[model samples]
Target: MPNSTTDTYLIGDMKNGKPFNGFFIYPRTNIWLIFDFYLNGKRLFQVYNDLLTASMVEDTETSFTAISNKNIFVNDRLKSGIEVTPVRVKKGIVDIARNVNNFRTTGFILTLFDNRSPEYIEIRPIAHGYELISTDKNTIEVTYHASGKKLVFRDLEGRVLTKSKRFNSDHYSITLEKLAYTLKYRLVDAESLERFVKEQW
Candidate 1:
């Protein structure tokens, strides 16, 4: 479903497969939209409502507060899950909020993958972010540097997944479907996703 307000902006072209996620604060819908694209032509998505709150918005202010000094313990509920599983982070974290000046949009994270094979994800820390490679060869390189004013992403296609910069409403935002079409990849809308979301939720 398309968002109603023009207030909606895209935070996409992240990666097409497992463990790779692209996210942004989509306020107009007040719903969590999760998407995943896979190499074997599989796709997964989920949606949730009413997760946003004043506290979460306030926390976005600190989402990118120099993680180099602290080993932050992230207790996030994520999508349809009701539990907060704590994941400790020592490295390989890049908070987009650090680019308050460069990126005006705000959003939370979303994961798109069926809990199946390609069992694990490998993360190698780079300059500002990390390089993520899945067992199935799905690769994504993320770099966000506010100080140097550099923000780049390479997901799936070895080269930059995005070839054009259409919207800077948040410093580089594009829809996943649009990006797929631009890349000449098939646009998939799984009908069973609605039932899948319910099953997972």
Candidate 2:
């Protein structure tokens, strides 16, 4: 098995010659897993909140499915103009293309790959509803809306990084230095409150 790591990639419309820097996490093979994508150093998808995952299927042509968790927070705020595309990377001697299509509510497909099975695949989400508020060497802030409520996320110190709105949701996230923290609304509203900690990037 290949050890999981974030691999840097240069991806975009090859014809344009303006490929942006991106990265994806490939922790394992044969199973769809979360892929983190970025463009010009800005994370394009909230893979941690969206729970994005994908896997390649064996067939005459390359095929795969990328899915996001079906949760109210995501469903309520999903951008109507979502766009997806397969990214081809140059790995040594072979040039592999991970063709993707059939985009739907919570997932998409990697239709094929240049007539060969790809050892790995990378997918990119063109637009997500959230907007970047600010960033510094130590912290980053982002904002989005859900259930008619505004959400503001900041790095450590629990500061109101953005002036967009007041903290409305019981759910929120924060990252400071090396520590990641989140308050899941679903878990908080559940019958039993369970303490769960998850790593985010």
lDDT of 2: 0.29
Overall lDDT per candidate, in order of appearance: 0.29, 0.29
Error of 2 at 197 (Å): 9.5
Clashes of each: 4, 1
Q: Which residue pairs collide, candidate 1? A: 16-37, 24-107, 25-106, 25-107
Q: Candidate 1: where is the Cα deviation over 4 Å?
A: 1-115, 147-157, 163-201
TM-score of 1: 0.22
The C-alpha TM-scores of every prediction are 0.22, 0.19
Tens-place lDDT per residue, model 1, 48-144, is: 2212221134446444231211111123212332111122123221111110112221112212233331122333445555444433334454455
Instruction: Report the C-alpha displacement of residue 8, candidate 1, in angstroms.
Output: 66
